[model samples]
Target: MESCGMSFIKYLLFIFNLFFAMSGLGIIIAGALVLADVSDFSHFVTSDLVGPPIVLIVMGAIIFLVASLGCYGAIRENYKMLVAFAVFLIIIFIVEFAVGITAAVYKADFQETLKKSMKKSLEQYESSSNNNIEKAAWDNVQQKVKCCGVNGKSDWSSTPMSCCYKDKMDESDQPEEFCVSGGRNYIYKEGCYKRLQMKIESNTKILIGVGIGIAFVQVVGMFLAFWLAYTIKKEDESK
Candidate 1:
């Protein structure tokens, strides 16, 4: 009966290692997608805001490596390796919990910070003829997000070319004037900051979910690892 139970646990742990590894891959993909989405409006945010996603990606990679160690330890019935694996899982759990909390806090302050950032970017945008990172990022967000200025079309001193329908617009005739919502060249009425904010908030959900899911997986992995280690030690002592 003991041999049967031990074999069952070994198989279960091996299977769980596979599941844990896949969870890690999911986190990596989630982080990559969120990072890509953020890149479109990168100029509107400080570089430090990217830290959470990067940490997720790095943690995911570490999980993949750790999962392998767990599988090896379980299959080999190595008590020491299983203890080490449990320790690593505990460390990862703590970090993931902190990241999730950080992300939640960041979300709470996101709107105000984004609004300020957008205002700063708009102030630096100056003109349609001016080419700079702010202009470039703003233009991309306007087109991709189907949004206008910081608040709305009126936030601009004059409507930006990005707010206009490209093919229908005649820059030669009105350059940046006819985009005030009257004709075919009417600008997008929505605000870039709001649109981008929604996108960012939505993406943050993915990160949060990954963090929560990984924490659960880590806890289970730690439990199974320690239990297996104890079982293996017991069997060795009886011998």
Candidate 2:
């Protein structure tokens, strides 16, 4: 009977360690995906800054080590090893909280920057390009401008200055240039990139969901590892 109990405990410990180690790996991969956001910074007040990605990598290392220790400790019935694993879990919990808070603060800053960019874009439209110049004369205005995926080259090809929406007016209060190409309505304005804003919003929500799920998984793993460690010791005593 004692031998059976020991074997059962050992099996539980092994399963727990295996699942958690793989979970940690998944979290690490997700963190790498978040790091990829560095490529797009048009809407950020602060850059990707390297801090969060580095923290995530470090967390992955901790989780891997702790999970390994839990497995080894359970197999060997080593109390010291179990304690070490618990310590690692505590440290990881603290670090996760800190990183999460920092990200929230940064997100607020980015939102402010996005709002400012939109206002700047509106101002630029009012001050420049009254839409009166011929396509040839206004090539420069149209060149730097993109609305709904239409550029100056296509804008010139259209008749009666068909490149723009009449709703977008200039400082003189006349209808400004708009484009209906690319299956979306758009007004050409400086300092505004809605694509970047949309990207930030979408990514932020995804990251938040992923973060919560990872934290929950980690916590559950920690408790299960601790319990399994105890079970292993109890079996050894019975034997």
Candidate 3:
């Protein structure tokens, strides 16, 4: 009964490791697909597109190989093999953590740059155009617009500034939030610019989230590998 239980546990661990490794592999493949510059593959590394971190791709490959080795070690009940695989996982985790930190720093810098660029653009638009109609449109947007870090809440509101916006809009139907009541006799030119900036800010947040998640997964994978190896080694020594 004891032997059967141990066998079952080993099988379970193997499957768990395999599943994580497989998931990592899939991430790698998807990342690669995005990285490819073939005619069929839209250049995935564009500033607009969210591409997986290159460090993640490397770490994922390492995790996948370690998981494959762990499966083999479980089948053979070889403590030495398992220990080797676990050590590799630990190294990969450290590297991944370092990469995640670097990514986070880069994101901060990028966001700072984005805000500065947006401010400069707004200033230029204000300087170049002086028409009252155009000025009114910009004035409306300025009143309603919340910049990347200007307001704490109720930011990024996409309310329409004028009725002219409805006719010139790409889509016939606009969301309630984007649609202003009645007919807007005048439209703000800067409104769309501010909206575009808001989208860029939101996307930066999403990329930051992805980097954090990858870092967490690497930490978890490292811990599990080490714990499993220690337990398996102790069990073998007892026998």
TM-score of each: 0.88, 0.59, 0.51
Ranking by lDDT: 1, 2, 3
Runs off by more than 4 Å, candidate 2: 1-3, 42-50, 113-193, 232-239
Model 1 whole-model lDDT (C-alpha atoms): 0.81
**lDDT (Cα, tens digit) per residue for candidate 3, span 105-182:** 786565555455444444444455554543453344343442121221132233323323344434336432333446
Identify the leading candidate in terms of TM-score.
1
Clashes of 3: 3
Better of 1 and 3 by TM-score: 1
**Judged by TM-score relative to the true structure, which candidate is superior, 2 or 3?**
2
The window of 10 residues in a row where model 3 has the poorest summed lDDT is: 37-46
Report the C-alpha displacement of residue 74, candidate 3, in angstroms.
2.2
Per-model CA lDDT versus the true structure: 0.81, 0.57, 0.52
TM-score (C-alpha, index-matched) for candidate 1: 0.88
lDDT of 1 by residue, 83-171 (tens): 99999999888877776677667765877887888887888887445657777887788888888998888888867678876444433
Model 1 misses residue 12 by how many Å? Answer: 0.5
Compute the lDDT for candidate 2. 0.57
Clashing pairs in 1: none
Clashing pairs in 2: 164-178, 165-178
